[model samples]
Target: MTDVVATTPGLFPLPDWAKEDLSDLKGHQKGDLVSGGEGGEIARAYDRVRNEVVDDQTDAGLDRFVEGQARWDDMLAHPLTVHENVETGGIVRYYDNNNFYRDPRVTGELTFSGDVAAELEAASGLLGSDADDRLQAVLPGPYTLADLASDEYYGDEAEFLAAVSEFLAGEVEAFPAHATLFLLEPSFVTNAPDDDLDERASEAIDAVAGATDADVVVHTYWEAFAEKPYAHLMDADVDALGFDFVAADREANLECINEYGTKGDVALGLVDGQNTLVEEPGTIAERVNWVREQVPGQEFDTTYVSYNTEPFYLPTSKHVEKLSAIAEAARLAATEGVEA
Candidate 1:
């Protein structure tokens, strides 16, 4: 029985230990935030926030732990955008949410400076033996990052996408082979139709995901599977495919899964990540069971029962409750599956 792992997207509500200055820091862009230096007050606050969320997720029995990414004020565009030659541009909407990311203009060659892995290394070090194989790190997928950025140096879109993939692969190569990495690919589902775009995107995604020696889970959220170019996701080489059922039509998502079939594991975003309506574990378990009913006789190697999107939209208390409920639902599902 695969355990329902409590994993979330990078962005999350700062814990109580984080102060108002940190809250103010949230409104600033990545370039502006980085000007304060890595040893300043905001960095310390982010450290506190990371510790709190890590402790919270671990205490709640979450199977995988993220660094909480409290420092990612620019959302997924950050850390990468702040590198050597990339210039930060105007604020733009990040998916179907109020959140935004500074448009990154690739003025020069993009290179991974090993910062992404280093960001998680501290948090990973804090994890005991229990979380050795369970500590997860997050990276914006190549296609999504390319979609979010402007190619100033590499004018050719194809070459730019390949560059982004190689840049991301550098980070993937740096991560410990035992760690799990989540590649967020919201652009895959929301972008307009392009015949070659889907295939190129899938190839770039597969290349970046394949760079890592450990398990990689590619997640697409904020849209239905049928409405998007995600049908090609089956061809993307990754260990798991995660769908946001709360944002998509649940029936449509299941149909897509049944039609194409998963190449590896399945991650069901069964719990709501955009609201304050605290759902219970029993309720989530019932939803999991209902999803299972939709896809019969298919053994999902590792079903990740987690949030449908970023949980930062929910209130602090509600987010905590939602995290616990997700793990409980996974536990209940595993027990029931075993009994059956």
Candidate 2:
């Protein structure tokens, strides 16, 4: 029997209390807070928010918990934009969404300074002994980072990609042993690279995955990959590849799985993260069974039922409801068996 786990791909809508705390701290610049000029109040606020996020996930009965990247103001560009070597440029629209992130302009060599690892350590501290069994670390994949960045130093696309990959690998190496590592690579579907560059991209992903013992999942959202890109993605040495079942091309995504078959475990983005409508447990379970039936003879060791992407688009209350729904749906799917 396949085990269905309830989890998310990271980033959550900030709670109201957290928003208030952060708003008050906004008067003081982040640099001053980071440099300990403001008594580290900003850090303390983030810590409290992370703790609340963990508690909420635990109460919802999720099998895994993310650090709830509450401090990431710019989503995918946070790590690079904060680095001294990279300059923050004009705001660019994030994918096709209304959200915008300041473009990271690479002015010097990309280097890892434990940006994400520090967040992971703080999150692990919250879970205590159970952290090793439950904590999941989330970060932007090298390809997405490189794609979003404006390279002024490397001058070459492949070199820039390699450097970014190496930088991320360093962060992964520094991470404490955890349950999962979610590499969010939305660009793979929204703006996929040329076929000739597919091998290099997969190699970049493999390099990051090889650095950690955690179960590595390359998650893509916004849309599903076409046949060739999906095939190239399967070539990567990751434990699982996540697909957006809520996207318009979901049927094509299922077809890709049927055609190529998965290498190991599979993460089904059954919950629509962008929408506020809560799906019933029975509906979600039926979708899980549908996926299983669509791809016969292909056995998945574990099926992770999660949001198609982060639910940062929703309000905190709705986000909480969605989290509960995910856990309940996973339970129903496992209890009823795939045939049901």
Best by lDDT: 2
lDDT of each: 0.76, 0.86
Give the root-mean-square deviation of each candidate in angstroms. 2.8, 1.6
Q: Which ten residues in a row have the lowest lDDT in candidate 1?
A: 26-35
Clashing pairs in 1: none
Please provide, for model 1 over 1-340, each residue's C-alpha lDDT reduced to its tens digit, 9 standing for 90 to 100: 6545656765677665564665565454343334355436566666677788888887778888888777676777775677887988888887778878788898998876776776677687778665558788888888888888888999998899899999998877887534578898777776732676777888898998888776788887887665345667678779888888887777777778787777557777878888888788877777777777788867776778888887866777888888888878778877754332
TM-score of each: 0.91, 0.96
Compute the lDDT of residue 260 as modeled in candidate 1.
72
lDDT of 2 at 122: 87
Per-residue lDDT of model 2, residues 1-340, tens digit only = 8888899998898888877877787455432336464548888788888898999999999999999988777788777887879988998998888898889899998877787888889899989998999999898998998999999999999998999999999989999779998999999888887876677788899899989899989988888877787777787889998888887487878888888887679988889988989988878988988888888878888888999988887889989998999999999899845364
